[model samples]
Target: MRQIPLALLAPPTHRFDNFLPGANAEALAYLRGLSPGDPPVLLWGPTGSGKTHLLQALAEHWQAGGQRVAWYDADTPLPWELPAHESLLLLDDCQRFDAGQQHAAFALFVASAGQGYNIVATADVPAVDLDLREDLRTRLGWGPSFALEPLGEAEMRAVLRREADRRGLLLGDEVLGYLLTRFERNLKGLMTLLDRLDRFALASKRALTLPLLKAMLADEKIDSDPNL
Candidate 1:
């Protein structure tokens, strides 16, 4: 197996909650199987959805229980070299791998599938469209390939409320409703906005209000630049 790049495979700094209502059930079920041992699993979803969150949650769970866990992200090259022995494997954005990485990833997938070592992958499309090698695609589809859909309005609101609570802030329905109407629809994007707003508010000695949100939204320079 080839060595996966460290920067590309790392998970996010923030915590991902697994209790999201709209999160895929089968995906959670696959994660649950990791309790006793690592099981190879794959999750599919679009950007700004919950793919990374779920990955982080799974990693945190295993790590908390004193299990060895590793994560690989899109920035890393594909066909990740599997560990010599058994350990949880999380390869995100499996489809984004280059041709060589894809071949390597397929081979690793085969090995992981055979051993039932905990493995999870995320892709933009289903396995078929990933341009994966034939055998590897079949193996990914063979088990349960969970698709994470865009969170609905209600679910998104709940997520905002919960995250706000976690941050020791008060988020009312009015604020949530305003954000839902004005910001991007995805939970991930909304969370990003919330995090930024929280920091900005604290620094500027302002409250979380519609005026501030509007100011944040209207800042064309920041709005266009996602990293802002």
Candidate 2:
């Protein structure tokens, strides 16, 4: 049997509006002010901290302005070509970059400095802790750096309830607490889990609760990885 692609099912999107600021309101505000020729910005956070969301949102914002955006991730293969003209450079997952990617990223930094293009990059750790070459790592700290943090417990609960209410789905207090503790704490992971539960609850004609959520995880086999 052929399986349907997840994109066609529900393509993922990252918009500034969808992000819950929690304690990152100032950081969010900073990103919105970005434009062509802005200095590089470094955003560092653990998984589920919405770093990816913000980076992609930047991409969309630039593209909407009819500015060309060049994207490169640590997972992207070698021979990575830099854009010829001045363009927005979005570098993601800098912590995982190998030696070759590090060299390319250093070049991108030079481009942003010399060519008047804006650059934004995300990593799992702060610049001082980044394990790349010294000069490249130093370049990462050339501009404003924000440490994106996970939402507090109360904030996460509120966000979950707001999302559930927006979707007209019922989730209990127990369910919310369980999600915060048992699953990943990042916004994207929690939202994905909530989306999954929404579909599962509808299909099974069941009221969402802690027990049913556990059952769904058991059947789905995604709970083995906390970051999933």
- Put down candidate 2 lDDT per residue, 1-228, tens digits, no spaces: 223224223444577887787778888999999867877899998887779889898788878888898899977887777788888888898999999999999987875686778889999998889999988889888888999998887877877787888777787878887787776677777888888887777667778987789888888876634554
Q: Once superposed on the true structure, which residue ranges of model 1 sit more than 4 Å away at CA? A: 1-18, 35-39, 77-79, 110-113, 220-228
Which number leads on TM-score? 2
Residue 84 lDDT (model 2): 80
For candidate 1, lDDT tens digit of each residue in 17-80? 5357465766666676655344456678788667877787877777777777767666764446
| Candidate 1 lDDT | 0.69
Q: State in Å the error of residue 98, model 1.
A: 1.7
